[model samples]
Target chain A: MTNLQETKPLMHLLSATFDSLQSATPEQLEHNPFLQLRKQGLDALARTGLPTPRDEEWKYLNLAPYIRHPYQLPAGKESLSHLPQILPITTIPVVFFNGLFQPHLLSPVHGVTVTSLAQLLDRGSHDGTALGEQEHSIGQLLSPEDDPFVALNAALLHQGALLHITQNPSQPIYLASITQSDQPLFVNLRFAIRLSTGTAATIILDLRTLSKTAPTFHNIVSEIWLETESALTLIFLQNDTAQNYGVLTTRIAQTARSRSRLYTITAGNGMVRNTTSVQLNEPEAETVLYGLSVLRDTEVADHHTAVEHLAPNCQSSELYKSIVADQATNIFNGKIFVHPEAQQTNAYQSNHNILLSDDAQVYTKPQLEIFADDVRCTHGATVGQLPQEAVFYLRTRGLPETVADVLLLHAFAAEVYEQLPLEPLRAWIDQQLSHRLFDIVDLAADRKLVDLQFATS
Target chain B: MHNAKQPLLTIENLHVAVDDKQILKGVDLTIYPGEIHAIMGPNGSGKSTLAAVLAGREDYTILQGRVFFDGKDLLEMSPEERAAAGLFLAFQYPVEIPGVSMLTFLRTALNEIRKSNGEEPIDTRTFLQRVREAAQLLELGNDFLQRAVNVGFSGGEKKRNEILQMAVLRPKLAILDETDSGLDIDALKIVANAVNSLFGTIQSYLIITHYQRLLNYIEPDYVHVMYDGKIVRSGDKTLALELEAKGYDWLRSETLSSIELPSTTT
Candidate 1:
């Protein structure tokens, strides 16, 4: 948008695709309310094409090589034979295969309503008044112009889900967005979750790819609205294969006395960037954000978050930890803004990282802007290796060097994941993390590095 | 201990250094089975260095020396190997490891030792029972075992926790490095009694301290005085009383004037 010449070619290609896709719409869907929203998204993308490293938000990430590849739109009818092995999946998820929602695969949870966007658009055309009201609410939250990825997702929005909760579900609702493609593909998906007054619900957004051969780029945008006294727990498990890329942008707004907790665990070999923005719309709202990324190989995961305290007496606490090994990278940037009227707001944030190898890297930044004089805000960031003293202490207890390393790494991440409200999910995360750490340890052991260090006289 | 009994630990001409600064200069000591040897020294006299080096701490550089434990070359083994070989050092400052509970640490340690010995893992019930009995010896409750290892513990509590670990590990040779540093009289007696109760024919102890008060509770068979990184005197229990009465300064001047060789040679 600011006269950046490098992003011109892909921008033109995406623009032409959007125009052709719009022209191919069925005659019955021509009067759909999403038509206007799609046009708005296309215009926003035209103004600001694919983000480059020059952009402030994408400073540490370089997507030029990734975006340079010619990616065709998803075929809309990929097979779902690989659904059973998508994850060690205990619960049947609301499946979105190739960005298309499958209603038949969704199990009906208590007091929750799941509506496909395609169905909603079809009904909106018949009853324009109902769709018109929905459009207004969705439009305000999905401000596509805020981010290039959000705009891209909105422009190519093929299918999505809208979840409404009226009571607390007995188990967490699993929304799985999966991509299974042999050819390079581009997928865009959207979701909006609304909780009624005094209602509470937990959602697990698990994103992955069935195939690890061809690269699939998934851009997702989610909008969440918590009413007065409602609580929402959102956990994002991005465990994609090595050939996939993901960008998730979530916007959440909380009303009076509402609570929200977000946990982001990215253990994927592919690259992922998660941007979350929370608006404390009313007083007495509380939010907790926790993230842990155990990355290895050439993978990269970046988390960018912003919390706004617009009302008084709001509290927000954030802690993000990363265990990066090999040549991988993890980046965290957290921003907390307290307005003048938001007095008595208490905000705290901390980011800690452990680099096992010399090439492993972590970049962390904490930005706090407070205009109120009566607010309490504290932020800290630390990047260090494993403490040698602690390692020796563990080793002296009859644990081998590799075993000692694994135990310490597990203990380092346990501080964040121990707060998980769901026991099964917590155990799953613990197992997943243990597998990743053991991989690292086994690799180290294979290199005979442990032997070289502790060689006897 | 009779002369016919084989030695549990033997340190000969042990010269150790840290970052090029020599700490233990030609230290020699030998302990037989069922013997308790107390080494009294002032601060920085290398008493702690001997304990650390024996436990296979890698921070110190072993310039010239050899250590044998149960007839095996101790210097050639890694820390875990040394640990599994029944060598334990009660650290001067017990480390605080957050997020790792005392129960998990001990269980893991015991299992690893058992694993290396080709033994099966103990059942959870038996393990918990053992931990309960060990905790009771230190007057500690089960809640204390559930908390993070040594985290937020007082000085006395940390020292007692070390003894609790010693009780569970049941090492053949235990080296206590300044275990009585920050203990009150009541905590001192409790800790000393726990050590005494754990000791038997198969267990020997090397108690390192700055004061002889701990020896009053857990009596030592031999008392050695360390001065300037070397053992200056070795005698029976009355030697500890003499040193307590005369203080370390007397031993320092006496060693400087007489320049007598360590009694290990005799």
Candidate 2:
């Protein structure tokens, strides 16, 4: 890997970012756990460097455009002037701006303990207990040796959230992260969640941008641990702008009879990459991963998922759908691994894509590796265009060309959206998807046609 | 009779080609209000091509000639425009629109046609009432309206759905393109009964078929035999029976010998 990085020559693009680590406050560096973790992360990144197209996992995605420039750490200010409108729901929300946790935006909660990681580090610093041991245990859940982006995010981690659910929560909890800055900025965020035994809850993580043209780069890492017989639903909503770049890595581990479902909906961004990993460590554990991406213009979106069944009688299923239009591009890579001891494992994976224009492109790879002899595993992929016969059929019914196209596209996407567990959230996401897909001009013209027909009839 | 009145549709020396290959050559026909005209032909006799060209399908190109519907240039209108102008074609194979329900599809079509005629759109209650009546006429259950358009329908069900659409939209000129090709005897009777119930003095039909069996149920006032993209013979309903009894070879040989070409039919 070192020799490969030396040959690429673009690996130095991220080395310049390490020098900016001195910008951290002296007090933060004084903490032994924070200082050691940052040093270890930096060393790991220096060895592996950035990924190139030659890498098997990144064959379809290139990171040269994102890593060419050196970004400075943003010193975010406490400005409530540009906050997004709060969702109209009975839940608690924790807001962060440019990787800085805002205390004023934290809402009250009754059944869970929520705090910032910065605050935890501060408390550990004054208590004189060995915090490094605890940090090392949590860091074991992620493998930075295999991914350079994970190392980069860990090296620059500053502010994030820590949630501990001890009992079944009465309401959902939301973590809203807002990225905005006047100049080019790089932000790293970390989240650690622990759901205790027999507890059930839902958590929504929303990544949003205030300005559409702000040049911001965000690196986020989340690790979730589900105890025995617990159930949790984790939803990630990525709604950035055309000028921003983002990388998200999620790691989840399940115990005996535990259940977890991860849902991701990606819409707006110039470039976005998502990596999700889940491990069923005990028997009878199950996990489900579902995602939908709608891209237009010259935007690019990529999703890479890995699910490992390490114990017997475990199950995992994954389904992802994408629609690309104009000159946009998309990629989906899903891998399922069944260990030697994972007998009777039932794993299924599928990826479906729709290209709406001549220039649109999609690359899908669904892979499976089963070591057990008695396992039922299947994986497949499909890429296609909207049926011309269906479009002409609708046109013969008096629907205009654009209306017919939009209707068919919506139907293709509804297969994934209709499966959302929450009713209100599904409705909200459906509205957002409609607004993103149809322009105001097309919608207004359709309305006028409808009115004309009504008036004449 | 009504044949003395102004014709509802007039085709003059129409020549059409699909994929740059001529499929229709010098076709001439006319239909008046309140007349049922049936065109019978053998396979590859340009029967479906005529229906497709009338419906404004983009696959075909008009090499020459013209078509006028209700004294307006038909070739100049788009498919949707033609539909709104009270021209309906019951497709030989109905398309499957997976997400759109039958009720929504029918309602949209009916409303658009009504709008084009300078009338107000039908309210929900009235539309539902009309749909119930049409469904009952076609012997379809009420639950069928909620299913996706032709997604899992059998051949007979799909044919019935097309007639149900026609009943709701109420087009002035109805063109049935091989509607009885894949139907069983019972389904054929049901479809024939539906079309007969919807006929009126102001409406006309251009039923294109290959068998003389369909005319036995919905009798036609005129029967034309198409051979090599042209109508070679014309007569009353007895012509269909004569052709059915003697087979299309008799007409093919008659037309081919007149044109000085060897008969290709066996």
Candidate 3:
């Protein structure tokens, strides 16, 4: 882009934000104490200012668009009692509208506290973890000093969830967000999930927009803390409308004996960037990461992930797959780090992409940082089309070129979708895959594929 | 009690070359609907080239030839279209597709053929039944169907799977390209039995091999000897034995000496 576009101020874009949302936040924050603190925190953020491209993480994904646009965090509104009937599969469900929390949409479950970030901080019990002792870590991470959007979200996150699972919670909890923003504006959300010792559960956090006419911006920060003997699986589904712009920052710290797996699938939108980091803090800790992004028609989706093993006997693996068709561009940066003392560490990382059209573009970089002499850490990245032999093998069986292409594409995507163990999650993802393909291939033909002999014999 | 049907496949004046290098020169062959024709030749002979040319392997570009399957313009269609029209090729070396289960692969290929032929896809129950039967036909354990196609499979198991695929496909014209090269006696017997059963049906096969031993169980109606990209002679099933006893060297010398050679199917 030209320098003029880069320097333009967001005041020009402020006219589009959902700015009329101050009155509804108080009651929502009262139900969830975190809302009260968040409002105070966001007020402090407003005094500060936004960050420029000079920030290292925001280098490649310049926040010119975000910086140019002005937005106020939507305050927590009255209880959103009537949640949408069209619900997706989730373990622990949380609702946020226009960047504020909707508590009535939350399910009341045991062994877990379901309150606003305010109440959870004021009255919720903790085991002295970072989130328990330093609830402001998110605030610290998002302040204008570190991140402008973080500060904005801290000030604006009307009612956020303070989800704390005690020792070895047996069931998976889902956090689903359906953003019904009324206009083209900026929205930020913050979440902190802390798991105590011996706790094991799966979590699905989904972010989606209910409206499409307005141009919207969603900047999110989520932190996951895991203690010893804890197992956590996080699935992040960002199904943004094409008129939306989003940036998500996810950070995780896995302590001794803690196992963590993070997966993200992104589709639709003008530009979307996801930055995730998994730090293995102690020995015997393992991490698994698998993410897939499908972009269609003049869209751009980028995913950046870093998995670091700092202690000995730590193991981690990351694999990211991107499928871009038409005029879509994808950027993937995967890095695996092994500290010097982290000998016997096993880390593997790879990023693979498939471009369906000549107009599509992809930039992928997989890196390994190893200071430990005895560690085994490797990384690789590739962007290409389906194998010719694979295509021919299918064609020789009587499938048309289009059918063969779709089948191979599905096989490539199955690597990511199949990693999701939940049946409902898998079914939901499969439905999305069908629609994603419909954007490229004629939907009628794709719909007609059901007549296909699933088994040729 | 069997009524002879007209020949199901005919290859005439088949001249093929791969990358401008001539491989098959003036080769001819014909097979009846129930007949199994075995072509035995020395290394570098046109045995494989003929099979590839017929299956439309890109390597062997057909320079001069015509193949008639069910009296249609077979050469005009693609390899896949041919298969859908009742043609099956048991590859000499089956390709491996990791992350793809044999069950899914077979079902997809089978379904593609069925759909192209305007038939409904098999229901789960019927599909499973057919898989079980095909598995038994080749003595393959049901576990084999779950493994990736030919990946980590024993040498013998790979060949058996080729036959199993044929049994599942049930094509009218099955082409076995060196299907028995790497099989042990037991595997060879299982494969032979599979091929034997496939006979007496509407299906016929063009079996290519370097050895005459496979013909022991799955006897061929006619055996032709190919050498140097040309079929040098045509004879009954006994011709394979004669050639086995007296190597191709003997046939080469006789072809050069005979002044009044009959105008055979070449």
Candidate 4:
């Protein structure tokens, strides 16, 4: 094939993508001034184009499976009344369908307000400041090489939610975003949460795919900006179905003496990708990321996170544990970067995985890039099955094989349970996990390390 | 084939080693019903090796030996299998399994032993009742049942817990390997008391220790002095007192020359 033939097909796809970004019109953005910055952001997204297998980030997790199932946007007003009750955990619900928000599906808190990204853009940029993703970097799919999914998310800029936490105390605000999508579609949402000094609250982003077989593509970007002396606790539970393909890009920027703690418990069946990056932009800042996942069958769960200490006196601890069964696969990439100026920093990360089947695979990489002389950094990764000695001990005690297996599994997950502060929510998640999981009681006898499995209330 | 008529245990020349280091050269011993045999030895005398060899720790290999109990071979069994075969070894260092409650471990071990004995399974009510009785006799608080096995326990508490396990399992042959090492005077007495209360004419015991302090509470019918890889002397409980008074030097003084005399000539 000549160069003309190869370039010809790419030319048509490029033209189509360029036309899509033309959705950036004054009328579409409405009465917004951030449109100027938004246009520049979209132009950058268009320039990056769609990533292919050549891109390392998307190497292990290909977007081709999602791209093959092209989807049409939702038409007319959908029946989201039934969806309100679906988010049974809290009163404040932030609802989205195919990446589009349905203001009708939410019951707003008295002091809280709910609006779409289009409305916010129409209102213009924050105080007319020109902060247009200055570094202009889209992380890679598997590598941080700038994934095409991120560009696709940026292309559909108006379909996200503008979740403003603001500076408040009263009662802790509960922000929930539920996605109820139809058909195989690509839904992109950008969450902007700005917490002022001394502001505190809880936020939850719950992804719900309304169908099972027809695939769904959900590429979301969350920007969490923290102020000095402020604290934010975000719990993300991605419980979408097996056929859904989704990736979440969470970018956190914390201030001096500010602390941000994030707990992500990913369950359910799917090809799920999660990217969480925490930037220690100021001194005396603390960031913690705790995650637990249980993937079975042929499902795949990939987590890529980086905790960057750009300032001195910052600290971070990241622990991620996964239990894979059958042919399920999990990949964990946790990196800790300490800049030369960031002295007296303490950063630690550990990724542990338990494989139930011999064929089940786990790829864990823990990287530490330290340039500072006075910083303390340690990172370790381990992937294997339950300890045979621990297993034999439980089995000898007369626990059935299935019961022993369950107990061993529960023990593997107990490390993350230590970080969850909410009892009810933790209990609910633990209960649901035990229920949906395989019958582990029959694994064998003499497996003694399982009392945690019976900790279910 | 093991009915009520069978002897509790049978042993042949049991040679065991840990990490290829032979600890027991050729140990020959046996115990029938209604007997207590105390094997007293100095440090590095391999008394504990016999206990561990019988417990079926895979870390030690029996190069040449046959251990039969209740008409079945004990050497050809897993650690838990030996326990179910009515053979128990109170470890010198009881393993601490975090998150596993003492009550759960004991009940499971006891029921497995019972099941092997052909008795009906004990229900939860009976299990709780038995645990309460055993815990009280062992001086263990009700809270101990809720805590993880051997975790956060004092030296005395750990010994008492081991005896508490022996009381619960009611094994045919209960081997105590330095079970008195970490116990204080009071804890040692409590553990000994639990041992005395749990023992009966139908069961037997083989207690291994360095000092004569544990002998003050659990009186033994026979005391054997273990030197090098063999039992050099055998007597009644009075042998333990003579050793405490004369010291292990008395046996070492005589045995060292006889073995050393041959080595000098060689």
Q: How does each model score on lDDT?
A: 0.82, 0.77, 0.72, 0.69
DockQ (0 to 1) for model 2: 0.36
For lDDT, candidate 3 versus 4, the one ahead is 3
Tens digits of per-residue lDDT for model 3, A99-137: 667666666777676557634443533332335566424
Query: Against the true structure, what is each candidate's TM-score?
Result: 0.93, 0.89, 0.85, 0.76
Sort order, lDDT high to low:
1, 2, 3, 4
Interface RMSD of each: 9.1, 5.4, 3.7, 4.5
True contacts kept of 3: 0.37
lDDT at position B167, candidate 3: 81
Q: Please provide, for model 1 over B1-266, each residue's C-alpha lDDT reduced to its tens digit, 9 standing for 90 to 100.
A: 26787788999999999999998889899998888999998888999888889989998899998899999999999999999999888889988888788887888888788878888777778988889999999999889998888999999999999999988888898899999999999999999989898889228999999999999998998999888888988998899999999988887789778989888522
Put down candidate 2 lDDT per residue, B81-127, tens digits, no spaces: 78787788888999998866787677776766676667878898998
Candidate 2 achieves a global lDDT of 0.77
Chain A TM-score relative to the true structure, per candidate: 0.89, 0.87, 0.82, 0.83
Model 3: number of clashes? 21
> What DockQ, between 0 and 1, does each candidate earn?
0.43, 0.36, 0.34, 0.19
State residue A34's C-alpha deviation in candidate 1, in Å: 2.6
Candidate 2: residue B37 lDDT (0-100):
90
Q: Which numbered prediction scores highest in DockQ against the true structure?
A: 1
